[model samples]
Target: MEIISNEALSRCIRDAVRAELQEHFKTGGSTGNVSRERLLSKQELAAELGVSLVTLTEWMKKGLPFFRLHKRVYFRMSEVLETMQQKI
Candidate 1:
């Protein structure tokens, strides 16, 4: 087994992330041939929707669609809009 240095490991991780992001962007933030749907963080979504963080949290509690990655929450704009329309 070959031991990898910290710098080498870090570089590999960075390169991998960069490649994945490039692919994600190339596909318009999607994995397959689907409609473009940008992922927004909790803060971004709240700002875009002109709502406060507490309101967004309430929406989440009410079953607004969202996903978690690395302990971070993310919402897809398309899904959020659809959910809101349904709620209306």
Candidate 2:
């Protein structure tokens, strides 16, 4: 059997790990805690979903989707994912 030295083995492992991370960073969508970030303003919601401010307010007021706190609004990543799954 062929064997590589310790340093060569480490280098190859590091390169493979780096490549995997690069692919994750490039293509992994917001499928985790990132969606649970701080409260986003209505305008920010519209920007994220590519909707208009009025549409956002309508959706919020109707309780269609979104997290709300008094006059504030936010979103949890998991909630969004679940809602999308349901729609499918």
Candidate 3:
């Protein structure tokens, strides 16, 4: 058995991640695919909905599904749209 070098391991991980992202984007680009999950920043979501950031915050308070990683917040586009449909 041979030990993998740190550089080789890092390169392998990077390549795997790149491939995964390329596949994700490829499948996610179709409009009729509802299960394609994509993350959006708060600003992006607000712009997509044609709403202000303040209004987005209000929506969060009203139970919009969101994820927080440290100081960053993300919204899942599919979930957001589903929530909107239910509310409507």
Candidate 4:
């Protein structure tokens, strides 16, 4: 069995993470420079899905995919539909 020193392991891990971050930044993050996915507001999503705000809130609690940015809630229609399909 071959064992590496703690410092070597740590350095290797750090280098790998740094390289990944550099690549991510180079490509303008996970979604890339221009995101084609349009983010919908809570009300917009609720209306689009033909559900009430209350039901949307319940779905959010039940693991419906959502995200909060700038103190506001948002959802991607594709993700919401995918999550709902999974729940069924």
Against the reference, the lDDT scores of all candidates come to 0.93, 0.69, 0.91, 0.91
* Stretches > 4 Å off in candidate 1: 1-36
lDDT for 51 in candidate 1 is 99
Give the alpha carbon lDDT tens digit for every residue of 4-73 in model 4: 9889999999999999999989876765355568999999998898999999999999999898998999
lDDT of 3 by residue, 1-88 (tens): 7599889999999999999889878976565745556689999999999999999999999999999999999999889999999999
Local accuracy of candidate 1 as per-residue lDDT tens digits, 16-53: 99999998889767666675567899999999999999
Candidate 3 residues lying further than 4 Å off, grouped into runs, are 1-36
Residue 63, model 2: Cα distance from true site in angstroms: 3.6
Assess the local accuracy of residue 41 in candidate 3 as a C-alpha lDDT between 0 and 100: 98
TM-score between candidate 4 and the true structure: 0.61
Which candidate, 3 or 4, would have the higher TM-score against the true structure? 4
Evaluated against the true structure, the overall lDDT of model 1 is 0.93
Each candidate: RMSD = 6.1, 10.1, 6.0, 7.1
For TM-score, candidate 1 versus 2, the one ahead is 1
What is the per-residue lDDT of model 2 for residues 1-88, given as tens digits with 9 covering 90 to 100?
A: 6588889999999999999888877866455555435566667667887889887677666554676688677765455557657767
For each candidate in turn, the TM-score is 0.61, 0.40, 0.59, 0.61
